[model samples]
Target chain A: MLFFEGSEKKIEVVLQPGQPSLRQLEREYWQQVVAKANATILSSVHNEECDAYLLSESSLFVWEDRFLMLTCGTTTLMDAVVSFLEQFPADSLAMLSYQRKNEYQSHLQKSSFEQDVTALQQQIEGVGYQLGYLDGHHNYIYHLDRPYQPREDDATLELLMYHINGDTAQYLRSDNQTLEGIRQRLNWEALLPGFLLDDFLFEPFGYSMNAIKGDRYATMHITPQENSSYVSFETNLEGEAAALVLNALLKTLQPDSYDLISFNQQLQLDHQPGIICVDQATQPLSCGYTMRFSHYLKPPSAERSADRLSL
Target chain B: MLFFEGSEKKIEVVLQPGQPSLRQLEREYWQQVVAKANATILSSVHNEECDAYLLSESSLFVWEDRFLMLTCGTTTLMDAVVSFLEQFPADSLAMLSYQRKNEYQSHLQKSSFEQDVTALQQQIEGVGYQLGYLDGHHNYIYHLDRPYQPREDDATLELLMYHINGDTAQYLRSDNQTLEGIRQRLNWEALLPGFLLDDFLFEPFGYSMNAIKGDRYATMHITPQENSSYVSFETNLEGEAAALVLNALLKTLQPDSYDLISFNQQLQLDHQPGIICVDQATQPLSCGYTMRFSHYLKPPSAERSADRLSL
Candidate 1:
């Protein structure tokens, strides 16, 4: 169960005309939430408005009255949301999506479904949708009406997750030399021209990552564990998806297989023949947010053959 | 609205101990079913036992009474299935999967579900699944429990499809000289190495392809129609998962994003961190068949911005 959660949750609190400093609210929330907040400023604006912090698991973002937090692994995220809301009024908006691997235990199943549901539902009248296939659940998405949902047609969020298998995953898990090879393959500074990145590798399990980019941050988290390794390329900004960046990421990740999710304000995929995209649901959720989950698949038996060969 | 239908409908008619030749049955079915049937032999050992045929928007296969047929576009498939069952006794197996873009109309909506269901139910006992999202429907998969499902653990089949965008599509669509450039980029004869490939391009809206490497094919179908084009790479061989082909396909297809589905006789993905595979359902369908799907997506907003910039 080496699956890492890629789901996201946002908390948007509207402070009255001249309410308490957002900086004060953001600071208090982090100090109370993150266990080891060896917070390093990756990059940010002058007033720390569009700021990003790399914590134990992933990140914390603070921009004006809006604070967006995302963390994977077994991080105590829901409680952090509940705690921070004590200062803000019940009118605050929230959009939470917590997704993990088929093998990983869900935070929702950890007896927090009703509790967190109560917490967010108590604040805004929005509900949550538990999405996944019959074999196992993929993630949980929760969003409120007003401030949390995108008002503009341009603001779109897309996350691409890759599960590297065969030689690519094996090479990365070989040793330090492989890590160096991957690092050289990336050449991040040259490939991702403008952004300042913070890079590191996790011990024992060999998880290599870069919690990066300028104020409008993007990240590359690679769990380079043998047989169970994964690489995730995520960005919230429109421009982060430059041509070179996309090419460089694909070459580096070299996953045996992958899946795509498009959370657009209202955009739908242009038509293409010969390529089959299995759409999960393109309609808006009960709460008015819309997203499309489409996938191209490798025939199912390949994994079993690989397993037999491995044994 | 660019989507392709890769779903397949395999009609397996089990004959008696001394029934008519499966070859004759296969040919009779084809001439009466698929139009024109511009038959070309890719590969097979001695007899046309394990063969693959390309029709006008459809394909036919005959492997010792385990006949499998697949069709995309506005194909009269179910009617074809019904006509052939006349000569043979009951107890046939059917596995049908035909899916398209969100904007494309579902063949099922045209009142074909009951016709096909009745056609199959008239002979054998099986069911179907309507898989896709709100923007458009995708595929229809059907199968029977007794004869078609593999008892051997080694059996597996997989297909990889990509909705290619960016320069790859542009270069291929530019002109004949650019087609030469793309051909050089592909270097199929050199890259594919083994069997001879049959390559061709369609008129009006260009469709370039290569179907090679014996009966176990490695086909590349490129519909280079700007903003509405796709490139599909499909293979069923176990060793085809080799890294070279994967790299070559990515380099040639150069898709902005893509997804994959692996259909296994009994394969479940090895666990990975961070990646959450939304299982449609883990338990074997009533037919005792199983498959796994994975994806790699570009965040949605980027596409919109790209669309706007193009404007």
Candidate 2:
């Protein structure tokens, strides 16, 4: 037997010699205390581990399986396994360490295996096959049924000359060796319809027209006396298409005029002289009988102010 | 009479009205033909009433002498005369024609003749005065001594400033305001003296120096062991004079190892162990050495290959 003293009173307590005390028994106790404590600790640790797993699961899914195997040498694998064990409860220390070692080994084997599979899949597809699939399945198709046709043979050349002028035909055919080659050479300026200058349609009588082969329209050399001449249309088009289009275009563009006398009379007026008349009943004519006889003058205001000579 | 027959050797002569016969003889022929023909046509025209001299002499001179009783005008006198002529040369001709008629009646007596004589003489002398003459004497003195002494009050702002700066008394009184103002306002980066920093002088120890304004130099926070410091000359006159006159100035600039340590200590170097030297022999001895070491060690070569690392 052994005797123990209390702190507040000198009370004696008896115990078996060499036996464990009640305080030591609390530490050694394994019935419900040890198990309950372990369960609480493990549940909290497991919850934390679950939270970390949810947070990083997508990242792990993307790279963990492949990257882990790449860095899995002896020391690196050991470090991963140890980190895995540290996330488990201390109560389940043995089982968690064993499970972590197995997981590390499995990751290494799976990463190595996937590399071989990926290479095999690439070989099976081959180059250019995917590109052909994309082109056939998903591109637009443009079909030009009436392709541009050009004349290379003598007969075709003759037909072209019959439609266009001889000069135009000569220009088109001089550079091209084949019918397709001549067709490719058709420029925007050379493609105008032949009806533009056809004499039977738009005959230039009072007015004159000059035809130029290239892009720009020919210039006209109309004198001030010939200003009464105008562009006339003979088309069968209707409504605004006939008058509005022609008038609007005429308003913007000017008919070119040059001095024919300066050009040594190479250009000439095709029409008769433009005439202007004055009546005898005007203010100046009423002042004198002699003014009434002056109506036949070529220039009416010749005797008036010098400024009046402009007209 | 002389006569000749058709069948025989005979001759006949008949007189005609306007014929030169021997009866219209020697004295009359010499007077009409020889003497008149011998006279020069120019001298005969000069003797005539309608002489070329009537047109050649300026009508202006004739009118002034006959009507105004004045001599030819001077340059100032001509100004008003020319202005009148410019408006009316024909009117001036008419006036001169009237004057010519008056000159023919020069003997006419007049009551105001003395007064007219005095006025004409005075006008003539007035004209002579502007022509640089006085009485009968020529005044050699012409333009004033100082033709134009422009007033200082009329000077432009820039010219005033130039005058102020040029005057030594004004410059010293203002302590060279113009130079100081210009230096402060100008963009000195473009105009800074070349080779100035490179030539900063180091004193006795032969250490290198780099001089810069306090505003231009960057503040560097360095550890005590790695302090890199410089001595600054702060006086305005010293700085300006140094910039203007110094040559091979680096010889006077001194930067020692001791200065660097003191600067680093002031920057709290003890807190930054990484910057301090741990090993004696391998440690950098100077600021330049430390800078080179830092540059070499930076970012620690990412490439695994030794050849790429060297690059």
Candidate 3:
């Protein structure tokens, strides 16, 4: 199978006062935005708080005052962002932040961080900051400097995982795997509790899901092929809820390493057993948000040595 | 320019008794070995202790009891190892090791580590190991077991750097760059001291060099493109001297991150001022060698924040 870039490009925008609720916007409008990014809306779900899209490449979520859209593969997310801006009055934009995670195969990307920044600058001026090392797990962020208010409860945690292992991973690659099978294996009832979930399984391989409850949301995208296997879990859940889900999923997937990015100090991950935080950085953005990036790695097991002997 | 896989595939084999010193093997014999790996020999140099060849893709070094050959790009170094084994009796193999660094573009590689291990298994039984996280900076090693003697003084250090920056990186990419200029830029006088150096500059932009002193050897290869830029410094030198060279090169190249692998505990690096060791592991290999792998990252600087603002 051809390698897929599971790392995503994300944009979150908070609208100014008097603007229509983003959830009121028609699905056709959102579909155009997704199309501009060169992706499609496979399906979607909504609750009182948000409209969540299960995208062909990744996902999108919309709230009354804000909206988030993320796409993977070689989709031109900057193009989508630019097209999105054209639909709204420039004065209606209270805040705009664009982010991209460093890819395992950056050469396959359609645009570099610099190129994206250049594209974003054409519509709105923003400062770009890089968190962590350029050679390793890092994030590129461009934040537009519009007036904005920070919500006490506004927070987001994104966990991007790589090289997943174990029976769960094997099952993910198996022909018999199903969305319900994965939900059972992951035990979403315990991990996500009351949150509602919407998910899809792709032909040959791959999976994507969106879950919503009140104003809280959680989404997951899994690319389980060997060599380039990856899984990303993201949530707007706060504190212990976020950490609990993080631990539970990690226990199930057992990725060799993962990069965690938190916005607004929502997640304070306590030390995880068997996993060590390898690299971390906290940067306050010009866009009025504090961002923290941490990379965690599981210790190489002694069993790997024994397994190598059998090989 | 297309991205080059700067990470290397390496093999080192020790010969049994009554065998010809690898250094005494004719240049044509080494040429065939390089050819088998699908790389061309660019130049060569020798000292009393070793013979080193600068290849189109990387470098090779030959010593009396053992020889180390490393080639980058998509070259299949395992094929060379298999061919080299044919020239000698199976009993003449004292020990063998084949290693591959996790590549930025693994899908572009001719073979996976598993495939290479399978190929090697056709010749000899060897224990395979994965050092460090498979998703991050890591190494795969397959070591063939045979009668072997471990020497207290036998040690090797390899520093693989990525995403290098600063004037040195720019100069290396510039048309004005020359071998002598790089020598002065890196300050080999302080780094290698008594070592005799031989080097070459590739067309467009790239570099390869070899250095030797008595029974010790060092080799360097540079791929100085933007997205996939990489440089590797390796030496059989011991202790503090090795650390000194490592620090000096880091100062000049200013790579954002680097992976250091030491075999037989040849180097004990003290704390570096601006860099942090993000990951570290020590493994005792079945091939009578202890290997230590450490990944270091320079902290994101305040200056980077300011630089982003200017952009």
Candidate 4:
């Protein structure tokens, strides 16, 4: 029988073939397994306990001087648990001793809530997210109805990729193996750009995860400027406007085809109107026309009569 | 014989194509020539004169405008006079008012010797060429040597090379036609190191005739740290020691020849010797050899002393 820990509670065990009941199994055998698993969790949690707090109930539990907590879950839940355990292990509990009890609890609650909010926000904001406020405050509080859809494989890959070096290509070429082997040859600078160099840390390409297929070719799409205006409306209003224009342009043009879009005061051609894109290039757009508006006119005699009546 | 002005006195002449008497030339012709030359000299003197003083030629004579005279060697004197006259037209003397003085002997005797000494002192100290001192107090001093240097044909082009754009390649590529042409082709950033952007004002390349040249290519002999203990005598001794060792190593190996000198310490090989010869790379040397020094051992006595000192 195996027990799994979930976000809120412990999962009930469903006995498997050849597995003994709790009474039949030797106490020492279970104790040893629990101790070994706890040690593993402790070691992993050393530096990153803040990120690993969720894993506390999943990998091990506190029982007297020691703790034993382990459970099973859906593959997605398992991956999340594993990742959390990996980043923040049981050993991280030592670091917690230095933190004030109230402060630590508050910090843990705030971070956990933030993680949940971020996950929810990202899901709700997909494609087209409304830009409005419920009250006077500028709070972009996301609607909780659209729960975050976690991709287990992507989550796992992202976790692994975070630790993988950028120059893993060299090792991959040498070994001709996929996954773990490539991960073992990580350089801290290549794996974590910002950690090594302050300038590269915030760059779009710095935190990108390479997509891998089982027994197939790996593909990587670098978001060189991932936070560009087109990706999210949550960015600056000017950026949002720019993104809107780009999205419209991308929709109008077919991929792998090239065309020059000239914009003037009036549409020169009938087929497709060229949109006026913002100037991101070094050179100013030539033949650009400024849009002008005028109010409808009335007769000079009627205007004079209206002015005289007002006076 | 053409009359050419020498440094001290004007050379008067009559072009006879044979031996001619010095006094054979008509007084009016001599006066005409003298008037024309004197007008040019006076104009040049005004342009060159930064300041002036009113002084009596003698107690018998009323106080009038007096030129603070400059003395020069014959060759320099001729060059100065020629340069001054060449700047203006030949018949410029008719524009100025002239008066003849009857008491030449008395006027010459009353000339201020003290004023001449003061002018010479100011010239030496880089001052007082334009204005004379009144009652031994300093006044406006014109820089005479400043305007003396002759401008070359490519003077503006040279200035554009060393300044405006500072692109040596562009300056070389542009046909020595016009200043604007050179400016259009320049890529200033490529020529100068990014750190030295402010120091660009002080042109390292000699653009002006008086500009000094720096030692662009020099073999700086550096002693190895192990052989020389005195090398570490400076404050921040650790940093100095490392720089000396690295500089020596760079010079010996000439790593710059292969363009491998730009690799940061973390990417560099340990077995590779210390000496590296860099060409234009003037990045301040860093403490790269600290890790390498760990492999080497200090003498036993020195180690013991270090331990004792620590206690």
* Model number with the top TM-score: 3
Task: Provide the DockQ value for model 1.
Answer: 0.02
Q: For candidate 2 chain A, which ten residues in a row score worst on lDDT?
A: A154-163
User: Which candidate achieves the best DockQ against the true structure?
Assistant: 3
True contacts kept of 3: 0.16
Q: For candidate 1, write residues B197-293 as lDDT tens digits.
A: 5545444444434443434454455655544454555554444343455555655565544435444533333222222232232224554455443
Q: Of 3 and 4, which scores higher on DockQ?
A: 3
Candidate 1 differs from the real structure by a C-alpha RMSD in angstroms, to one decimal, of 16.5
Q: RMSD in angstroms, candidate 4?
A: 34.5
Error of 4 at B284 (Å): 27
lDDT of 2 at B161: 7
lDDT of 1 by residue, A1-311 (tens): 24444333333333434555556654545666544322223333323345555555666656554555655554556666666666665543334333222222232233234455565555556544433331211234555544344444324344443455545456656655444566566676676666655555555444434433434555566666543455655554454354345445555565433444445533233222223333243435543356554443332332221111010
Model 2 share of native interface contacts: 0.00
lDDT of 4 at B277: 18
**Distance from true position, residue B202, model 3, in Å?**
2.5
Given candidate 2, what's the lDDT at residue A132? 7
Query: What DockQ does each prediction reach against the true complex?
Result: 0.02, 0.01, 0.16, 0.00
lDDT of 4 by residue, A1-311 (tens): 11111112111111222333333334444344434323222221212111111122233222112222322112122223233334334333211100000010111122222243343333222111111110000001112122222222211010001011124332332324443443333332333322211111111122111211121111111111111101000000122332343233233221111111111221211122222211111111111211111101011111110000000
TM-score for predicted model 2 compared with the true structure = 0.12
